[model samples]
Target chain A: MIQVKELLAILIASSLVSNVVLSQFLGLCPFLGVSKKIKTAAGMGGAVVFVITLSSAVAGCIYQYLLVPMNMEYMQTIVFILVIAALVQFVEMFLKKFVDSLYKALGVYLPLITTNCAVLGVALTNVQKEYGILAGTVNGFATALGFCIAIIILAGIREKTEYNDFPEAVKGMPMVLITAGLMAIAFCGFAVLN
Target chain B: MSKSLERLYNGLVKENPTLVLMLGMCPTLAVTTSAYNGLGMGLTTTAVLAMSNMIISMLRKVIPDKIRIPSFIVIIATFVTLMQLLLQAYMPDLYKSLGIYIPLIVVNCIILGRAEAYAYKNPVIPSLFDGIGMGLGFTVSLTLIGIVREFIGGCSFFGNELGWFAPVGIFKMAPGAFFVLALLCAIQNKIKIEGAKKGKDVSKIQSGCNSDCANCAIDCEKRIDDIEITQEDIDSTAKINAAAIEKELAAKGGEK
Candidate 1:
């Protein structure tokens, strides 16, 4: 029997305890790549949150309705990526037509999101967890929220770090990484919340 | 011959896909917890990269320009699937260790970047070598980071449980990955600065100029009517400067 409480627990757990970035380390590229500035990081985070949530639902439907029935589960990776690429393209066009501001804001990051591992990771992980469609979608949204939260927080830290003093060797990427390490360590405390 | 060899060598050191370009960090950091895993993941990526480069370079003329990105994805996905199957059948343990990263290779920027930047313009042989060289550089860097993390975190090299070495335990966790990576990057930075100071013959760096200065000069010269350091430009420049120190080091082969 799946309880609502258990769903919430899973949602919270995936976001903080098993964070896509800090804990699972699935999307370090964007975490490090985009987090240097809070604005771009927020934009990237928003794009990821949007992509991961939608892709999770789509991937879940594909897995349950198609792959499992045809014994083509092994093709999940290729299939998921293809779906993601198509979805990103479709969304880009849709946004460009309907929401010009967001399209411009997310410009480069929108396409880049198609390749971001966090989105793919959540899709595969939802499969791994054997989540039902509803559960998977919720988990996907929550996980993306968690990722957005973590990255935004890291981006804020990085913004502040720029003003602070750091060792000459540890000034830039090194220092930011160390900050991420601390953030990950702090996030480790959330394991107890489960 | 020498020119092609120079391009190959440049990919390996001066313009490494992983360190210098920072193209494939997701797979590099995620899979490099141990040297064995690093080697496994690295070689798998390399094989896929080489095959994809050859195919893409050959088909560059035929593919439509507008649909090139999607075409590149399709080509890379095909090679990634082949590698996934090969690993699942032959090297199950390494396959298990690599986990989802094998498939994740489909999206690795290094592969697609090569297709767009190098392979599309180059001949098959040079593209092939570029793949191998970048792949080796990635493998070497991953192994180096893995060695440090494994040794410091678990107090074990590879998977051997050392009785004499006390495990830090943190090294095995996610944060350890960041810490070790950061330290390696710092060391990489130090080496590059030292090399530049010593006047080593590195072609990657434009010695006398800052990145913003170079870009500014280019923008000014190219677009005389346009504004050169817009707010967006400033933010990106700041980001570039922050990342450039480590990039300079990675270019010098001081990290791996």
Candidate 2:
């Protein structure tokens, strides 16, 4: 019953029109904190994309197969969080064991991903929108891609502006925030696509 | 002041989670579209924070250090779910407005950060007050930001329109949150600069990763030592580098 056109629309809408960081404000912490260098930003973004997409698929299956049948939908919050924490741990171990290079790049960020609201936000949003498993997984990927795009852009901007002279009050984080506001305004222009 | 009162003071002013320490920016930015929404989110977080802090403090002795982070998360998520159900039953409007944010509270850095920094190490009463203090500080900042945004963006105060100039309309949207917070942080910096000029020891008024606990992403404890070493010997580059190398070895000594 779902059309390819509809899926494309979902993908575009989630990624560009309603970006996770710029518009929805889901993952502002990582967007701000780990974005000092483009290399690290891209690494963090890659880790997020991997974790969110996989976790969404897993969370969707668990919800649809287990929670719904039991009529314990209210327990979604706790269940999803525990699942995410465990999943992050599992992903960390897997990466460390199988791909040591990637583990080196993403080791520190892996632990922090457990507390990143975007992961939990995507899961809860999937439930709220009543998407099927496939749709939910796609939405999760799109949302995380949106986050990746925003963080890379911000990191690029920050690196360029690192040495620019500014007033004392507007030197550090305040400047970054102001830049984010302007970026949000720019992203707001994408609403026309909706 | 008593130890509990000092903890309260610390959470409120010395190390406020939002403005000062800059933890939990997601809810602060997303839910502060209006004063009422800000108050609701802040109070809900307050409830979760206080109760979880108390419980975590009680169980600090039992929870193994290796698994303490997961244990803290489970405790926080339980309270958040309970709050969600209570809000859904009694305050449906706030519940709807908050939506995904309610459940998202589990991953909020403030609760977990406080658990790691204070609750796990402190006693029950001080931890409880620390939670209440941080909660109130968060509530105050959110409400302040909400009032400012609502006043400008809506041309109204707390949903009551004042026949003033037309609303900017942007203040109510996503970008408005960033601009307002940016402006507030700038103002805070301006005050800190003025205080430093007057020789009031304004060293603690830092931005970004300079905070004691910073955000959940950056481990400020490790960075703090680096900061101290650099400040002590800016000219002795070779010495500082050697010291940093030594510290890195020390830190990684226990690991495989």
Supply DockQ values for each candidate.
Answer: 0.46, 0.63
Say which candidate scores most in DockQ. 2
Would you estimate the TM-scores of all the predictions? 0.83, 0.89
Candidate 1 chain A, poorest ten consecutive residues by summed lDDT: A107-116
Model 2 CAPRI rating: medium
Error of 2 at A144 (Å): 0.8
Q: After superposition on all CA atoms, how large is the RMSD of candidate 1?
A: 10.4
Q: Write the per-residue lDDT of candidate 2 for residues A120-139, one digit (tens) a residue.
A: 88999999999989899999
For each of the candidates, what fraction of the native contacts does it recover?
0.57, 0.69
Worst 10 residues of 2 chain B by lDDT: B206-215
How would the docking of model 1 be graded?
Answer: acceptable
Candidate 1 wrongly placed segments (more than 4 Å): A1-3, A37-39, A99-109, B1-8, B195-256
C-alpha lDDT of candidate 2 relative to the true structure: 0.86
Clashes of 1: 0
